[model samples]
Target chain A: MKYKDYYEILGVPRDADDDAIKKAYRKLAHKYHPDVSKDPAGEEKFKEIAEAYATLKDADKRAAYDRLGSHSPGQDFQPPPDWGTQYGEQDLRFEDIDLSDLLAGLAGGRQRGAGRRGTMAMPGEDYEVTARISLEDAYAGTLVDLNLSVPEYDANGRLHRVPRVFKARIPKGATHGQRLRLRGKGGKGFHGGRDGDLYLNIELVPHALFRPSGHDLYLDLPLAPWEAALGATVAVPTLAGTVHLKVPAGTAAGSKLRLSGRGLPTPHGKPGDLYAIAQIAVPPKLSEAERELFQKLAAGSTFDPRSHFNSEVKHGD
Target chain B: MATEPVEPAWLNDDARVSLDELAALSGLTDAALRELVDYGVLHPVDAAEAQWTFSARWVVVARTACRLRNDFELDLNALALTLSFLDRIRDLEAQLRSANAQLPRRHY
Candidate 1:
């Protein structure tokens, strides 16, 4: 029940003109706009600015707010008892704004519907929720169960959030950051108005074995030193199942081999390819005989891995 | 008794939302929407204002425009320009994300 100072929040003098107020608000709005701003507090700041602008922009609301003299932001002071009688409730219609007790008291505790008699009809506000699914589930369609707490207005016109559970089918090829809209599944409408739509923002959970890029999938394929040096057919794991991948002879570490049409399937266009990246693994320990064979091979071999390094270093200098 | 499972109604990008629905969802008055139309902010399905229908994505645009108008006291034309710029910025950011996602992973 804090008394918010609208003028102070907008950084404008109490006696500032409409044009000056508008200019200040615009500057702050641009700075704190949630879409454009990188600030983590931008959304909250934008809401505060919007609330301040909402009250100060209208002359009647400004006059009413100005009457409560010298009250600072966050310093709680109740409105005078005669406040409701003077405003007549009908003049105040702060649409969709949930005000504090002090501000709500000025409007006679009614947020909407000032002079209306019968049941007011207004469409419900749209609701958005994030839905996180596994990359595999996104690759292959799956039914997901979601538990959501939805706000409902009781008979006494008080709002309460009630939990509801439902199941939704995640269509195959659903990408990260995609939005799935469900019509008429949002907040309940007031009176006989239509309910709002529900939007589900999709987020793909990172897979342990696969990393998705666009529609394609990438996985690290581990190979022994001999297998990497000489070609071998290795079983690679895909979303569907394991398939044999042919690793060409002399495959170097970090080499990417593409397996066409083995990745996630899209609704339209061709399915994406899966890439197997070569990773060479060596034995940590060797027996005496193995060590002796390796030493003999090293003595006989004339291969120099760092032959180009000295030449490159000389050229750089 | 077990409750029936909820079946989601998937709406694509091409889905059209009615004017009344857009007005209710965006909290924008009909007059303000008309002004936005005059400024070429919204492209309706039809030419006539009374029978105007907006794309589903325009719902978000209209809501952003309403907030901008309320906070900044911007006229319809300025609001339209701002919304256009915002849209362009969003498109560029999405493109950047896609490009970054395609970059090869470096293993050190």
Candidate 2:
């Protein structure tokens, strides 16, 4: 097994006082603690820090660690003969235990499968991962697959990182930034400790036609000028199917038309409403007849769209 | 290959836990957990005299508290203050994420 230097992990000198070890531990813990840390590798670093602190803080464990002799970090070596007898762990091979478990023995927690004289029972690690589902999938329930490496004890009682694939369901009506916690879905527990949870952070992929806010959906409803002037039944697209929306007569631009219960589905409640913002779709190049008709209407009409602009308020030239 | 089935119940509000389960899972003592509730660091689903049940989400929060307590040797007051700040930071981060999603796509 590889040799780990606890003092080096905690960044303290060999003869450093107890208080110095503690202060160093606190600083590193604050920086790497999973709750406050934004670092991607924070959890693993924090665990190393905790294990180091656990061994060095106690006098007996520190003496045992010192007795293991000074070696370069990760150098492969075995404990001395007397060392095995002292902890009653003679039968287990070096491959069967971790350096953390060896020192955790001095800290007094039972390591799993180490028989009577074992180390600590630490809880499993919680994993947080992001799952990006398309807006269409968000409307209907969908499946997501995540790949993660979790710790596990082999048949010989050695810990190894096992790659695993987890499949989870993102329920309908799931919105961006929602956190879903799955119990016992994370890393395997150490010893007899409970398995940790898996947290899924949901992110909706951008859709070409729809904009989602929570469960609600927004889309631009383009209407021809004549269609806005005269009421018309227009085809509208929704997740389930296409439905006709009635455009009220004389509908103005920027009016939000509601399609009740036509948005994303919720797990347990009513689905959100969809809003279609009205946009006047004028023909970029009008035909000769169309231009003449528009010209005639302009000549016959006395309506002014700029009537709201008061005389005192300056208007752009 | 057959697809793995998911237990969606874990994500539901009904996935509540007792005080003992929370303590064992979080590596915090029963007394320490109560200190969290007393200081408003946590809000249990049911805070009755007969028993206190916390939402499953609190398990992670309690575990975070336990690690900070042991590593920093912090008293209850200090732990509570730090946790509250972390909570606010998490909320703000979530808000930022959603708000960013709504912004127009940047053309580069």
Global lDDT of each candidate: 0.72, 0.77
The true-versus-predicted C-alpha distance at residue A105 of model 2, in Å, is: 5.0
Which portions of model 2 miss their true places by more than 4 Å? A2-9, A66-87, A95-98, A105-107, A111-139, A146-148, A154-161, A169-264, A273-317, B1-4, B10-30, B44-60, B106-108
Cα lDDT, model 1, residue A193: 74
lDDT of 1 by residue, B19-107 (tens): 88788767899888888877777878786666888777677678778877876667788888998888788788777765554444544
Q: Candidate 2 lDDT, tens digit per residue, B1-108?
A: 223747543333436789998897677999988988999988888676569988777876887788778767889899999999988997887677545534434221
lDDT, candidate 2, residue B81? 98
Highest DockQ against the true fold, candidate: 2
Misplaced by over 4 Å in model 1 are A1-20, A66-77, A90-121, A140-170, A207-209, A222-226, A240-243, A252-255, A265-271, A279-317, B1-5, B11-88, B102-108
Where's the lowest-lDDT run of ten residues in candidate 2 chain A?
A: A109-118
Measured with C-alpha atoms, the lDDT of residue A280 in candidate 2 is 83
Can you write out model 1's per-residue Cα lDDT over A84-198, one digit (the tens) per residue?
Answer: 4577643333333234322433443244431133267666767666789898888888877667666666564545456876566778867676666666777777778778767
| Per-prediction TM-score to the true structure, in the order listed | 0.68, 0.68
lDDT by residue (A218-308, candidate 2, tens digit) is 7778889888988789999987889999999999887889999998887678998778778888888999999999999899989788987
